[model samples]
Target chain A: MGGPDYAELCQLYARYAAALDAARWDEWPEFFVEDCLYKLIPRENHERGFPLATLMFESKGMLQDRVYGIRETLFHDPYYQRHVIGAPLIHAATAERITCEANYAVLRTKLSELPTVFSLGRYIDEVVVTDGGLKFASKLVVYDNELIANSIIYPI
Target chain B: MDGAEAVFPDEMTWPAGDVGRVPFLAYTNPEFHKAELERFFYRDHWCYVGLEAEIPEPGDFIRTAVGERSVIVVRDDEGAINVVENVCAHRGVQFCRERHGNRLDQGFTCPYHQWKYTLQGDLRGVPFLRGLKRDGQVQGGMPPDFKTSDHGLNKLKVATRGGVIFASFDPDVESLEDFLGPEMLGYFDRLFDGRMLKILGYNRQRIPGNWKLMQENIKDPYHPGLLHTWFVTFGLWRADNKSELKMDAHHRHAAMISTRGQAAAAAPAEVTQVSSFKASMQLNDARFLDIVPEPWWKGPTAVMMTLFPSVILQQQVNSVSTRHIQPRGHGAFDFVWTHFGFEDDDEAMTQRRLRQANLFGPAGFVSADDGEVIELSQMGFEQKPFHRTVAELGGRDAADSDHMITETLIRGMYGYWRKVMGL
Candidate 1:
């Protein structure tokens, strides 16, 4: 509402990054609407019109399942990921919906090792003003790098 | 069992010629790695390069590598597929720099100097053949004896099966059918039935471990239920399932098949005691684990087929992909994963495949666990290069077995490696 308050949107983006960086994955689904689309895709695939994505979730329920599996069922090395998000550029906005893009990077720190840049990408988002507040309806992360080091256990 | 006596000696020697015992030096020795590339990759092996669907139109092409040598697979004006070395004949620079492109018009032109080649890799023109200033003058030009035909890019023997493309440097290698025996051929056909394939995307991962470790991880059927807890906790794979390690005659290739619904009525005590297998763990959205069965595949719900030295064809539930293993060095390698789906798949089927993609890429739920384990195994050899990894799980020989609990496939792969390396 009111031409998508730019400052408010930036604050929302900051909170999203904080949640992921802190490993509070259980609270991740709360940032999205009930029927949302979340995908992590390579820039090459997006340019070539390929449908495959590194991580794809059609609904908030699927996103929650991923969080649950990684926290409980899956076994991965212990590591922490810190996300640094840049200012959002609002492309279009209305009373009901908003479109925005932002540059982001993630650094991974394992045990006593120094932090290293794990991934860098642009988040292309479609947001809507729901009853609860502004929430993401679709988030497409298009990573620029082609080579992934070892495995990406945490979401970037 | 004697950890004290397992010291790596300076002179690598295999006292017993047993498949159960493999020298750790094989994974850490750079000299051995170079020799293996020469004997196996450069000479006799049929390496998987790309898919036919990638270059459907004439002039469409994709560049790949064999060992360290660059190669390009392109379709000519005559609609014939050709595999040629990517090196330019003039200055030896890599001609095709882009990963994939369409050379519809004049063909590929070297950016370094103006050497040109047709889509079939035939030398066509140079910057100034006769002269720089005048057309028919013999100034600053090649000799009259110079022949463009002799300067074409080096070509390889090419073959196709079930839409998959493979190439070999050896001009007289056996047919692709005979190379993949009757058993392995059946599995290949089942996964790549003549149906049109659609490119989903790719996941290129650089692992800090030997390339052989990646191949061994796929071949070893014993680790799935143990190392990847997600497989067991979610009931995707069980030790009680009907599974087997099918190998070619010379033990160069193998296919590991495991079918669902064949889980034993009661898992053995040892299986139940495994810390990873927790029947209580369940998923909130079980659709991610759903299986949309294909009519062509009637045998197993999952299959990991390896073509020796490098490629792996994998089907984990509904997600299908081809992994091209490229060795960077003795301690590093690149796993190029090409994910795909059938062209005729409906919207729901396509979404199912896309959703199930989380099961095996570098960040895959099932695959993420492997990169670390393989790296740790490689690190173990740093201190004891002479120490041998004990592979005596099922037996001392490399043979096929109906049971899933075995390292026979790993032994079988090494059996072929030893012969090729002349170790």
Candidate 2:
């Protein structure tokens, strides 16, 4: 099955990672369609078929609310996050949608501390070609680690 | 400063038995941590294990910890739940590695040596104990005095109440009812209420701070309005809200009860003055604040209970959970959140519980700040071991309060800590 060009899909993931790593949270929802699902869940629950997720946004509106929270509501020590994401492996594709998965490692560095491996996960995503551009229809971040650090300040 | 050294030793000091001031050494000293584990966790205290819903069928088990020591909570053939140490009695190995599984009828077996035990942790089979025959003669047989019953796994005293479970290392410890006392037991029953529990899911985070800090965080109502923007802006928790602080007779267990007030367009000067409060903040998806009150809540919209050394029972609006504080050492602890719902809840109620849960857990909108502050607080305590923290929000004494503006619960906890630790 063929949808968008492989290079275009690669560019979409690259830009998404770049935006997240830079903490450009406002640009996050733009990567997804107006109606989308974004979930960051531990693999433990995911494998058990449990619905609980570390962070779940059922709609793009919910994603925007989280952005508002990070920008205006939440109080946390400022830190920098870097994402090292692997190439996306497309599983299936149609004229309207594409299914793929990619591995990711997020490294975080606090102002006074050294860098640490904050999270290790893989993204299972559904991409669709909208009039604007290729956007995520659904993205499920399944983290391999059972225990998270003190908190997940930003989206993985 | 004149008689500071005389009244207090160099290792640790408190101001004449006053619970208001807590020493930094309490969170930094390794030796003191061991004493706390012995006095507060291992003896006389019933630590929260897991919900009965976790192991519904025979042979179902979940591997957990009782103050850092691995243990298994399983269901036996008789349908009675048992709490057994995960250690192999022979080689002293923690045999169970999986966090959860079904033991079925086979029970547990140590890998190093095929020493088998029943679901109740009784020694059932011992390979080669009777010895195998070699040609014409038997070799390496156990002595006639060997008895499997004498070599069974260490069994913990177990208690079950309204689907919740607790276990203790001390057999003579008080019963679960007496341990919680009347006031605390009423609050416990409000949440548990004999209703069947449905396990939603779990969230585990390693907080780099003392385990007691997690308890103190829930106990101290002063920080919720000041530190959590989501709580303050959304009116989930406020300084002026109708609230009350209640503690057990021993002051080791506590409950913070609060009823959410009307959301006013113009907030009071006191609340608006807080750094975390945002008057104009709003959720794009208003469903997060779509709180549907349950009959169990009675009047209060939220009730956070700290059950001494082990767990925190939470009933925050539509979301209810158990926060288990498993200490690793003086410096760190594992905070496990078990978000559950009543078995009678409908699909809509379950979804509401799940959505409202966004306000908690490690990455929660309100709770993430808690984990961060506890970590930073531990750092401060470690940096200056001689320094002490001031917990004189409402007053210098620890007592039940009628408002949410006090640190009385923290003081009360340290009051119990001082008595138990003898420091």
Candidate 2 — which residues are off by over 4 angstroms? B1-10
lDDT values for all models: 0.85, 0.89
> lDDT per residue, candidate 2, B1-423, as tens digits?
533443334678576779988988888889999999998889989999999998999989999888988899999888999999999999999999999889986899999898999999999989889888989788886787999999999999999999998999999999999999999999999999999999888999999999989999999898887788677787676678888999999999999999988865547767656865667767778888888988888889999999999999999899899999899999999999999998899999998998888888988999998999999999888777777899999998989999988999999999889988887
**Which digits, one per residue and each the tens of the lDDT, describe model 2 over residues A1-156?**
667988989999999989999899999999999789998888988998777887888888999999988887778888999999899999999988999999999999999899999999899999999998899999999998779988987888
> Model 1, B350-371: lDDT tens per residue?
8888878888888788897798
DockQ of each: 0.72, 0.78
> What C-alpha lDDT, on a 0 to 100 scale, does residue B213 get in candidate 2?
93
True contacts kept of 1: 0.77
What i-RMS does every model get? Answer: 1.5, 1.1
Q: For model 1, name the residue pairs that clash.
A: B8-B386
lDDT tens digits by residue: candidate 1, A24-125: 988899899989998888888889998888888888988887887678655666888888999998888898888999999998898878888889989999
Candidate number of the best DockQ: 2
**Candidate with the greatest lDDT versus the true structure:** 2
Which CAPRI quality tier does the interface of model 2 achieve?
medium
